[model samples]
Target: MQVIATAGHVDHGKSTLVRALTGMEPDRWAEERRRGMTIDLGFAWTTLGAETVAFVDVPGHERFVTNMLAGIGPVPAAMIVVAADEGWMPQSAEHLAALDALGVRHGLLVVTRADLEDPSAATELAQAEIEQTSLGRIEAVAVSAVTGRGLPELRGALARLVAGLPPGQPGPVRLWVDRSFTIKGSGTVVTGTLAAGALRTGDELDLTGVAKPVRVRGLQSLGRSVGEVHAPARVAVNLRGVDKDTITRGAALLTPGRFLLSDLVDVRVHGDPVAGLPATLTLHLGSAAVPVRVRPLGADTARLRLGRALPLRIGDRALLRDPGRHHVAGGVTVLDVVPPGLTRRGAAAARALVLEQLDGVPDVAGELRRRKLIRGSELARTGVDTATFPAPVAGEWLADPAHWAVLQDRLRDEVERHAKENPLEPGAPVEALRHRLGLPDRALVEALVRAPLVTRGGRVSAGGPAVPGDLIRAVETAFEGLGPFAAPEANRLAELGLGPRQLGAAVRAGLVVQLAAGVVLRAGAPEQAVRRLAGLPQPFTLSEARQALDTSRRVAVPLLGLLDSTGVTQRGDDDRRTVVRG
Candidate 1:
């Protein structure tokens, strides 16, 4: 929603359309201006009605597809500018395919050069070609930036296209520096669309892929200094501590912990160029391009050895192509970068692995909902926007309907299992249950426990009579054997070797009561202790009771309180007195 990249074959009026819309030409490079063609990405933006849209004008020359891709890679939407006079071209096909394959959802096809020809003819041809792919009824309009023809329609079409986009959510601010340089008074200024979250002046941010942090001393949007900016806004960020010579395109200015850097990655390669790639190629992720050595696992399977380290993660889509050819050999979902080489082989197994990790929701909104209860780290690993990952609260992934059902049933079973094994325990410890589940996402376990389950004290054992039969028997036996005495403290029960965990479970089961000072008592022990105290002959001190019970004072005070509270004994000035007769 932040930026839209324009792509098509060169001479397609992409730059001209941008110029017409924004009244500022995107071809800012002097060489580009001299050549009358865009060889690199150009930047511009304009406002339409209530919305502001930014443009990343990419070169359409086949020789510059890499540059074009770099320009468009961060944009969620795009303007597939097809020159109306020439209709669809080769690079247009590649650009459209790349956008589709890379998963750019919100977009409209702009058939520019309306004044030069029957514009609808170009629109019709472009529409027919796009129908063959998954673009799903591309909304296209014909316009000529030179004649100011159809400009109004182009703006309105873009507004409608952007209307349905998911609103941006606040996250770690990241600006992939597509352009960086120095201006006379500004020091080092790097510009890129706000790819993720908010950036404010004087904010301390790290220049990742580098060793030090850069502070934002100033910010400019559309050439005007601004105090703060949010995602999708194109801005030039002025940095402190970073020199123009020290930084370049591909360096990302971001909040710490928002992303990671790596080199090696596992990926599923689609459309491999050759039977096997040569041992080397270039890896393009975000705006950073680095050389890598390719090791083919199979016709489409491979491991890439990057020439240098780069920040990457699982589920991040990166295009691997021949650096020399500058043609996309294939694209892959990064399973791991700086990851241990996959020890397994076979395309079937690897493909299955990739499919399994896909959140499997049909759309962004669905994915967001499905991942709602997912942990932030896990969502990052999946490379899905955390905001889109559905969950009731922030920082949690929403469970897929099917997965949620399975989780609920599993939790119920696990809680019951805990209750059964340690009937004396009050409930399962939430943390303990999470460990037991061993879910890849730990947050899901926490969410499951937080809702629909009662948490008392710190334990997460079963909330009710979910205790197992065998555990119940073990607890009952322990209780009967310890009659008239306090039930063994948790550690004492643990000494019997059922384990501290199982004993804690028994405590949660309500078969036993845990006293404040680590004492464990059978549920009925208080009544029995009271009955025993009522039969004691005389008022006694702690020592007398200790001797009579043949136990330490640790056992006497609680026992006396247990009895006295149950009408079994009464407290006197210095000793305990019994209340007789039922």
Candidate 2:
């Protein structure tokens, strides 16, 4: 299914075109019907060339620009309706800029009420205005919804546009509802475009902005009940346990943990004609518009504090408006939600937020793959996909491929460093490694260890393939230095710097003893004790062993016992005599 929004100036005949194409009225409110203006969003659908298109008719007046933004927030394509009589108007330009800012790429231009004026003149003017926008090569259709002059051509062009769009892949589901009302028999019904994934009847979803669970009791696509709905489709959902009053525009129905509710987010503002924007305004995301305090975070950056939390993600786009005049200030793509509060004067902190927001972003697959190994809350925080939308895990995030590779490299280095230092120890603790990675969770490390990249035992470390010769030599030198006399500790080995990684390399090459706690033998003392014990017939006392060392009872007694415990010597009947190996 294809979902499209209609945008332009008020009195541009947007509602008229929708009514003509869909055979249904978009304006449902009594006041709006009486005033003949769309104060909020209206929904309708029509079949053009066998393809069904859902229409979101948004208000075009300057006072209701917030309403318009809510309508088009999740639309993948749109119809920029322009009145043929009054070519380009204020709301028309703002609507176009909003679309570009929100990243709506697939759409067409409709010059409406063509019969009331010269079709050629209006078409030329509208085309000229659009040429300056990101809407490159927008197919302009001149139509008289009353005369039906160009309806057939308009239908064909729209069909082609809808057919060319790629189907949304299954991932976390995001539905931005533009219209909500109670059907007499049904409890509550809300309509919007499904941004990603599909929803089925009986499936449980969440109201992100409201923090409530909504059950899908029924579903509709293009005005008819359907078993399932996929991405880019205009859908109406009959919700259980939610009232019409509870759900407002801009509230999103998402798979829980796939998105976060945040009031503070990082945004980049396009240079607009308007200057000296107040530190606060209203922000429209999805179908909800909330008053927000906007403090410029940088030269072209700002931090928005919404009156209430709104459902948003890093890449979601939004439009800002001066609440009083309702004029478009600029557009913003959400960078971080639940950001640390800004005090309107901290320039460095604000700049850092902007830079982090602008940092490298990775593809969805890589992120999901990374999430597979993260913990539940971390997964949710990252807003990675849940099961239905190709989200293979819950409570984790997916890293882009590049990020995942870098993370793997770091893990490998950490493991090698650990193995060298504690030759007696197995590997680094997994929990410690997770903390070092600073990820929301440790599941990614656990998951990656199972791959060809590395092996995880009692701890995690470099695995697979073989060690190099140079590292082997380094390990052998360190191990031989310890000889049969000493067991090394962590900090002491790190000072040498070539311990674990090099030692593991030597062990892998079969050149090092890699002694366990039980296997260590002190060289000079033990050999002398063993020689003295060989001449004795019974187990020698600690004093006897100490006396044999010719130094003190302190060093000799423990040293003899260590050799005995290591199986190189044995205690005799009295425990005071010792027997050495034959």
TM-score of candidate 2 to 2 decimals: 0.64
How many clashing residue pairs appear in each of the predictions shown? 44, 33
Q: Pick the candidate with the highest TM-score.
A: 2
lDDT of each: 0.71, 0.71
Give candidate 2's error at residue 25 in angstroms.
Answer: 2.3
Tens digit of lDDT per residue, candidate 1, span 514-574?
5545566667656655555545566766766666566556767776776666666677986
Per-residue C-alpha lDDT of model 2 across residues 81-168, encoded as one tens digit per residue: 9888898888898898888766677878899888899878877887887776666778989999888989888888889888877677
TM-score of 1: 0.60
As a whole number from 0 to 100, the lDDT of residue 176 in candidate 1 is 74
What is the Å distance of residue 549 in model 1 from its true position? 41
